[model samples]
Target: MSDTEAHPVRISSHPAQLQALEPVLKKVRTRVGDIPALLALAEDIGHAAPKPGEGSTAKLWELLASVTAVDVAAGRALEPHLDAVAILAQAGVEESKPGAWGVFAAEGPGLKLEAKRQADGNVVLNGSKPWCSLASRLDGAVITAYTEDNGRAAFAVNLNDPGVSCETPLWTSRGLREIPSGTVHFDQVPATPVGGAAWYFERPGFAWGGMGVAACWLGGTVAVARDFRTALAKAAENGREPDQIALAHLGEVDRIIASVTAYLAQTAEWIDAGSSADSSNAWSEALRVRATVAAAVERVQTVVTQNLGPAPLAFNEAYGKRMADLSLYVRQHHGMRDDAQLGALALKGDRRW
Candidate 1:
């Protein structure tokens, strides 16, 4: 498809009603052969453009939850595009650029998103968004733009709209070309607000919104492990000389994956118990999760590259794409660099350390 045409990808509306979503979920797993296309759509347009078939907000959330859950089930990673949409929705913002570096992975104020509203209540947006993970293939995008009311508003816009544009200027480093991370420009695009000013950050789910990255990171980590195991098994059958160093790296990757899973489970439980508000514990846990994921991803990438012998990186579409994809995906955790600070804060216990 050309850059001008709207790359159509409709989300199901009855996503929350498990029975209704099962089929779509299955379809996504088997049919997602063109990730770059989807990324381009999401990054350029937005998730809400075409309006999902399952119109209910609950259904949309259900669809997202199902996607993430299925990612967990199938040993596949939840596409960052989905995580981006969920994060924006949870923030109660009218629009969100899902791909900004730390927006999905850490604490502090997230990406600075700007949306514009006209006197007629028609919103127009103009801004450059980074890390729009699947920019090339999204039908719509929820973005944050400023309004005459002097407040930040969130809304969804269609990428196919004349106002929206995506530039796949550079592909992320992770050997995977499926997710084309790039900049998206919005110029006088029409948008629908999500809630209100306070709603953007005041929503109950705002804090946990950033945590979705951890889940995606975990999923990518799993993929790397699975890929490596398959490669290892194949090599053994061929009786090829195995690289002891690479084998050690694989073992390390496996251990890190296990640790990441444990950390995520703990984090999820904490989120369920409403403990995420305690910035001390919450941020601390998030930092550790981030660090663990980064390490795990690095190990997996290294092992895979070493074993694949550069052939995969240069040619194998799936394996190469996965590597590139994972590399870019793991970069989201740089926010974890502050884990120590969170730990220190935890020690203060309301004393304002």
Candidate 2:
């Protein structure tokens, strides 16, 4: 591939879906660190779905995966914003005004970030929230907070609000470091209620959006697989016949990729058909797909690293970054606990096949 053509990631099954994304990727490449350009690219790509049952939602997930394979850190930063916006829209929180959005709703005691109701019936958010991505950059956010009357509720806060203060970017990990995920301190920040209490998590789109993250993992894993492929290719090009051991390893990797892909396609069909709107099916499938995809991704990474050795790590900066970013991003999966919960639910629900 030519230098200009080489960077494009048509590495996945959805080549048609990636056509619209190529320009977006190219724009991001030249104008690196330009947030506005990235947002514009998103807008041009159009909303994931203009209406609840509309648009190419599956393709959107594929696009996210492809981008992540190219640059997992950037892909990680972008998916949360897009996914949150989609969920908020489903819950009837329309952004009449224009700006970027996010969700800060990692719930629990000691998680702080409480919402208060004043006598005037206005909501003011106060406290610290964790895992807030693009904390300093997002224009608005869909926040979950504890309120006296409603207990836990979802609220939409404008980041530009005077009362909102985000901590300095403090993520020190080499992986996903481009993502400025940190603490967001809400100090009496006024916000508009997004949906009735619990609506954010209740919306079916929430699970669908979660699947999209797995797609990004798939993309990142493909990127790692390519590293191994390239190592083999370089050997062949240098007049060395490929060893049977490496050839067999490649074949095994291919089989796993094909298996994961078939599962992704099946899940995408379910989501597009709106089966995900069914809570039982959505939750079960979400857990299943996440565990499956996460496992395949990690396996690809492990196999490639074990065989390729440290040359990619020591010599190739982009390859090293992708490896690190994917390593962190795939951790979003919950492993055996996820599978256990899914199996229990499947048994209780009598989900056949």
Candidate 3:
């Protein structure tokens, strides 16, 4: 059978899901300038967003993509909070309060957050953590800190704690300008351990959450591609046929978008089926999806910008922002480093093929 016959195109749930959020997304498009407003939005999404591995993993990713298609920064602000909730759920911990959350796992050379066991059988965090986005605005966070044995563990802490202080970095990035990621300091801040040592990275949910970020990247790409399509439609309506170059770019954009959509759908199915429960398989799948989506975002950005020229970027506020946000957002993939890790895994005979 041919590829088309083997796999028929099915209607996507994204349109219906996005339709339901049109009202909220309309507000997001205009009022996405402040942290407080974004925090509120993230909290609302947290209440409604689906968790991964719940047999509706595709819906969860589609929701993420839908939000990102509206505003990339809003999606960035929302993803970590949702990921934190998912982590809590996976760890069987009840959310202690009703507020926005963040996940701070990025570590730096000198900065380190240490988790110490108190005599009262509780954990306290000390030192500083890097790359904590919206740390000052968020109510809580799921942070990774070094345990006594020099192993990293996940801890849930209240950001409002007196011992916790956020040091705002000199963020000068044009993309995602509204969301400034900075360092957070903890001085004897009380925390609740979510899971045992290494559980944070070991859990299949970690990979699932990473893939959710890729969905956001895909959404941003979709938004940019839409602009390219709109430009072509406008030209055609004005009695100007798009040249072969423009058509070629559009074809490439379509292929990239279709490939990413199919990859995400198939991976979501695997996750919901429990096939990605294994740590190695989950890691491999997440790495591949993230890498693929990241590359697609880059190519789409290039072709869209090349096709549309500098006019839209200079005058179109929304288009420019989407381009910039996607450029920065997809950099979380770590380029060749992640690819090297995947290669190492394969070298160790962790092949799915």
Candidate 4:
């Protein structure tokens, strides 16, 4: 079959299972037209907007299990949740800066809460997670922090508290200038711990967390590729070949995207097997995926800027926004720079997952 005939990637149609996710997948394509919107969405949601079928390690796994058949049928069965602890950690800290939970790292630990113990001895949270997509928008989060054991524990934070505050302003990226990637602050926030230290590192969810982040990165890269193709097609219609450099850049993007997709698929299959839950497998795979995705996003920026030139930068609002958004989004993952070290460790099988 021809390239067009063989590579027909379409959203899954299991409405009851995916919970209206077809539109979300389409929205991701539309919203991530370039880097700016990508960054804005990253800043707004902390990660790519959680698609209907995706999960947050613990709460969403049951949902994932229920929909695994749909995922399998749709060719999305291997995309598992990353580690629960790590996802919670990254969600609360790494994904974006300038949003509500963005300030957690800067604040350090040992903060107090506002609400009393719950009926089940759980505490209600009362702080605003400034840029949280679902929680900040709704009013709370499943939060985590360092315990007396010097390990992280998880909890839920409520945004509706009188002390919870959010500044819903957009970041000043020329491309994705409309997303509400603002700051949220909390005072005397109340929270209850869900899982203890084991949840942070030794749990089963870490491998899944590693996979999930990679999946988001892969989606963003594809969006940029789509934008580039649209531009190239337009250029061809105007009696012009795409600049030679642009074509070369597209080639690079294709290479990285293909390699990462294959690797993620392999990792997902391993996880689904249930016996390959080694820490080394999880960490190394996660690191490699993030590194590849980050590189793909960077390549898109370089190619887009060089091919489209200053005209798009100045005249094309959509393109410019995506460019800017991507520039910022690629940097959100913590320890991404050490991806090489993680890869080395994975190759040696010497590190924990």
Compute each candidate's TM-score over C-alphas: 0.63, 0.90, 0.94, 0.63
TM-score of 1: 0.63
Model 4: worst 10 consecutive residues (lDDT sum): 69-78
Q: Show where candidate 3 strays beyond 4 Å.
A: 1-18
**lDDT of all predictions, in order shown?**
0.52, 0.73, 0.85, 0.47
Q: In candidate 4, which residue ranges exceed 4 Å CA deviation?
A: 1-136, 167-170, 174-188, 334-336, 340-348, 351-353
Candidate 4 backbone overlaps, count: 32
After superposition, candidate 1 runs with Cα above 4 Å error: 1-32, 35-81, 84-117, 120-123, 133-136, 146-153, 168-176, 198-204, 240-250, 277-284, 303-315, 335-353
Query: lDDT (0-100) at residue 267 of candidate 3?
Result: 90
Tens digits of per-residue lDDT for model 4, 276-299: 466655666566667766776677
Candidate 3 on 1-353: residue-level lDDT in tens?
A: 21111121221464545456556666666666667887888788788778999988887877677677777898898899999999999999978767999999999998989999999998899999999998988999999999999999999999999999999789899898888889999999999999888999999999999999998888788878777888898899999989999999999999889888998999998899999879879999899999999999999999988888899889998788888888988989999999999999999988777
Give the per-residue lDDT digits (tens) of candidate 1, residues 1-353.
11101111112232243465455555545535545432443343334422221124223333333443323322122334454455454544444333311121111234344666578867677666666645555555555556656676556666677876778766534443444456677777776666676465544344344454555555555655666776777778899755787678778776776666556555565565665555445555556656766776677777667766877667866556556555665566664446666556667763324
| lDDT score, candidate 2, position 306 | 80
Task: Name the top lDDT candidate.
Answer: 3
Worst lDDT window (10 residues) for model 2? 2-11
- For candidate 2, list the clashing residue pairs, or say none: none
Q: For this target, which candidate reaches the highest TM-score against the unseen true structure?
A: 3
